[model samples]
Target: MRQGLILVVFAALLPVVAASFLQGQSALEDARKLAFERMIGTASAVAERQRDPFVIGQHLLLVHATNPDVTDMTDTCDAALRASLSSYPPITNIARTAADGTVRCSAIAFAGNINLAQEGWWQRGVSAKGMTITKAPIYGRIAKRDVLFLILPLRSGDGRQNGTLTAAIDVNYLRRALHDAGARNAGTLAIVTRDGKVVTDSNNALAFKPAMGAEPDQPIEARDKDGTMWIYTLHKIYSSDLFVVYAEPRAQLMATAVAQMRAGMLLPLISILLASIAIWVGTNRLALTWLRELQNMSARFAKGDFKGDQARFERAPEEIAAFSADLHIMADVIDRRNTDLTQALEAKSQLTREVHHRVKNNLQIINSLLTLQSGRVREGAAKEVLAQTRARISALALIHRLLYEQDNGYDRGEVAIDNLMAELCLQLRSARRSMFQVELTCHARNFPVPVDYAVPLTLFVVEAVTNAFRHAFPAGTRGAVHLNLDLQAGDAILEISDNGIGYSVTDEAGQMGTELMRGFATQVEGNLSIISSEGAGTQVILKFPLPNMSITNAPPLGSVPAF
Candidate 1:
């Protein structure tokens, strides 16, 4: 009974404890104000130093132009006054005009010349009242920067109004000085008139907003709707309506508000009770004991065993729903690819046998025609024509025989370097009626590739070799035909050299198939170089990069192809 009474007393006292914590908020506000005031104090020190004396002198000069003695619209006194300003120290630019709005004389840097009659600041200075200060304007091509010019009416010994004195103030220097004062350069110091004309800002020292004319009701920091306290303070410059404002955001200013709130925690039971209710309403996963069979169904789908379907995706946790959708999409793609592969194989099989049958029948008919044509012709030209026709027909017949011997057709039109060179020599021997003998030597290793990749490459090699035989070793010259083929850097390399009274390789290579040889190489996306050294026989190296050789792993090249 005593313990229960003690617990009740503690709960009842928690509100009072929280209220005591709120009371310290006033102290936090005091600290914030002190810190902001310190920052403003620091920034003001540097700002004063940036106001150059030359700038201050021009300010007085602009105001002096309003004096009545300035009646000479274009007076020599204006020139004398300007010369005096330029001759004096701390002044970069100066201009003055009479109260009637006429520029009298102008002086700038000792080495500078500026026309005051057409200037905006000159006109404004002439029209300004006693102590009017104009917002800085970006003017003049000389230094072409934004500057605030002060205008003060000149006063004679009797206190009469004379011409005005104008002084140029560069705001860019003032802004940078403020930035150097703080960490973020977030402090803002403004020289405001009775109106809200923000004369100078720490950020855009030279920037003057168009609406900086005047403000009747200005912002003062205090509590917002959230009941947070803010601090805003203003200091009026001595003997002037201009106020310098210093302020900061309340939330940012108060550093100790959070520590005080945490130290004030009195009761944890209420917070715990609220947490339990939130957990019960939000969680409904398997731990809630809602679905057992659905788990088994999703497990099978995840393992890619989608055949035996179990429960639908109705009871899995929200996190697993996206995965379930992906399973359905994959099943559709696999089924479609399988059907396409099967149909394509069947069509390919039927077309292969048909092509073999038609090619064989065409070769047999051509051979019979050549035989009959040779019998009727008696002239040497007629017999040579029939002989050439017979040789072409035999080559076509060889193509058919190879096709029927393989299910893959890889050995049909496609030929490896070793096998291709041997076959070309045998066929050329049969086709040539000359007395000279032709020898074929093939030196190459097993370079595996697809038929599409090998066929065109072999055709290019065949053309290069034949051109050597028919034209290179002419007129019964007993010499050797050399063929060297290799593979390097995903490319098929072949070198065909011939030694047989080889016509100055340079001149002979320049004619006939030498030109056609380039076209044949391009057919296979390969390269052909006729590297023939004078009488040392013609040597041709054909480089063809094989397909599917992993170009991604190819060595970095010094340059790119023309294409």
Candidate 2:
């Protein structure tokens, strides 16, 4: 029970814990992604500021070089460049040079002409014949600082290059922008030229070095040498060939997320634990205790103890209280029905006893009337036939008397064949041979027959014994008559034999008695055969199948043909 309660509580808690855990993980991932985007946006804003000066200087130089009637072109262009340099902090130097690399205008006033057409930045600008941003910051001989140049070609009215406008950007200013933008995020930021060279970066060593596996103008996630996760987000500046890259440490993102998740999950986890404990304790006290008591009551009911007070079930939990009430009602119904059946069975028994007594008395009166009738007749065949009829009538009366005598409850309407035959032989001898006493003994086994079969079988036995007493012996004859009834393999066998002078095989004088015995055998569904010869004792045997005691009615007499 304790284990079951624990399992149920854990089952309910598992989903809540899992959902909270998943929610924490989702919040952490969202925060990390948001931080990644913020760093990228910061670097992009700085890159835009750095590109503003080149855009302004290009406009100024193009407007001045386009005027065909300007006599002081150098002074006009030089004044425009000086004004642009002062206004923008990232612009360090601006110059206008002819296609032959002779300086036409300069922010610095030089005494003589300086040729710069063969310089690396100048040669690349000449080949492009348009605005060109340098791949990496270079040490400028004219400006005397690490700088990048934006050169725009000045086209004549005929669309041929006349001179070039060169704007030099201060690398320190670019570096400072990268540093300040990255400092806000507590990570590294860099601006790289299109050819993978770092133009400016927060880290000094990383400046002018190749970017590590970075694609231009794309967001990427990678790891550094020390195995810290870094997200590198890139934004291309619009007016120049530069990429602004922002990298934030994954560990810092995770630290912030972890703190958030800890704050978010504390109360829910504690509440789940407390709720699980409370449910476990509450159910054990309020529900499980009542259920256990009800289980014990059911066990007692199985053993036939249905007695319980109504207050006991009323005090049970509401879930099973109605079930308890129904069980109590069912037990009461069974007890009342049991009492009713017992009284009915006792009344039925008394009625059966009275019926048996009345039947035995009525049959005895018939037997007595037959005996009186036999005495009124003379000593002839008529009188002999009356004596046989009286004997058969007395056999049926004795069966009812035996059934009445049965006091055992199991054998109430049954006759024990052995005891029935013994008492029957004594009664038959007294009814028939009052003049000479015949030694009669019954050898039989204990088997019960219902009253229906017993009546016909008893009469059959009486006919056989009476015939043997009358014809098997002569005057002054003293002989033994053995009556046997035994059970063998679901069959009953009755045998009556005498040690007396027997009749001839062809004698027809006792045909009536023989036919009468055969008729009684047919009525009981039995086989009767007589064994007699001159000067030999007679044996009458009857064998019949015994059915269950519930089969009270005999089969049709025609069904058992006499053989």
Compose the digit string of candidate 1's lDDT tens values, residues 413-506.
3433344345545665655636356555455544444445555554554566666676666566666666666667667776778774555545
Candidate-wise lDDT, in order: 0.53, 0.71
Q: Which TM-score value belongs to model 1?
A: 0.34
Expressed as tens digits, the lDDT of each residue in 1-563 for candidate 2 is: 65676667667767877777788889988986777667667767776766666576566556645544221354476666566566666677777788788887777665676888778878788668567887788887678899888777666668776667777778898778667766666667777776667777885333223354565445466776677666666777744377777666667646788887776677566776776688678778777876777788777776767775557767667766887787778878876787798789778776777777788788778878887888789999899887777777677767766665645322356776656777787777686556365677776666667777778777777777787888887877777777776667777788888888988645886687788788888877889888988778988889988857543233211111101
lDDT for model 1, please.
0.53
Clashing pairs in 2: none
**Worst lDDT window (10 residues) for model 2?**
554-563
- Please report the candidate that would top TM-score against the real structure: 2
What are the runs in model 2 whose C-alpha is more than 4 Å off? 1-47, 56-89, 95-121, 139-146, 154-165, 183-236, 243-304, 309-311, 318-330, 343-563
The per-residue C-alpha lDDT of model 2 at residue 174 equals 75
